[model samples]
Target: MKKYIKPYYYYYYYYYFYMAEKIGIRTATIVIKDNRLLLVNSKYSDGDYYLFPGGGLESNETIEEGAIRETLEETGVEIKIEKLIHINEFIYSNDWNKRSLTIFFLAKPISIRKNNLTDDGGKIKQVEWVDISKLDEIDIRPRILADILMKAKGDFDTISLNHSVDYKHES
Candidate 1:
């Protein structure tokens, strides 16, 4: 003889796994000066793409501190975070284990160290300031970001929950 289990037990088991899924926290700093945006050309498995100066946040650091550290590491630019502009939730359809919560901050440049560009895990190729108008012509991940920035007239109160294959996860 076999014992019978309630159907609701399976539901609870799935719910527990779903709630235990891990999420990675990321931070990006949007530093604009003289009508140009600071971006890093990062190399990936596929190719190179332009992205804002930011990266994964450490457990001990706050969001603002993470943004500042990432910017300095990628662009050698010291910045003071002004305000939180956008919060982007990115999920990969190919892999349910990969999820990211990216916090975007508007920051002001405090100083730029000359000839001190550091490598971010050997991903960043070159850090340069790109004209805001030319963003459409470049290869930027999450293509919607270009559209958003173009329409943004210094206001950044947007929350984007995008689930698209356009963003590639790091291997």
Candidate 2:
């Protein structure tokens, strides 16, 4: 007998309750300080990966509020959201049911917690500040995001990804 394994997204989509029409709204915070970007190393079923500090939005919180909250929870750092940088539509062309929209915000840290880390459903391994220039060397979710951020020149651009980034701006 062959053992069957479900994809990571399947477990996520099936377990979480979306507030609106099965469309999930996620917020990510991009905090850079001293030429370093804040990122969380997390473990998934497939493997470990790095992502910005963020998570799904709650019912009562505004987008900015949610972003701030999620960032603090995941990174143990208090942040002030500066502005919206990227809006990503991560919808699967083949699976409409597994659709999510992610809003990325540029943020600045206000306070830092020493040795304090919040549990992202027990998935987060550690939070670290990675040098901005070295972002390409790691595995980041929504892979194209690393490329876009690496080349971004203060101009905000929206990215729509069915399976890849569609908008590319060269500075």
TM per candidate comes to 0.80, 0.75
RMSD of each candidate relative to the true structure: 4.8, 10.5
**Positional deviation of residue 5's Cα in model 2 after best superposition, in angstroms:** 44
lDDT of 2 by residue, 38-144 (tens): 99888877778898888888999999999998888778899998888777776555544555788888899999974566655788888899987898899887667
Candidate 1, 62: how far from true, in Å? 0.4
TM-score of 1: 0.80
What value does the lDDT take at residue 67 in candidate 2? 94
lDDT of 2: 0.76
lDDT of each: 0.79, 0.76
Question: Global lDDT for candidate 1?
Answer: 0.79
Model 2 earns a TM-score of: 0.75
Mark the regions of model 2 whose C-alpha exceeds 4 Å error after superposition. 1-21, 153-171
| Least accurate 10 contiguous residues by lDDT in model 2 | 162-171
Output the worst ten-in-a-row residue range by lDDT, candidate 1: 162-171
Residue 166 of model 1: what lDDT?
A: 33
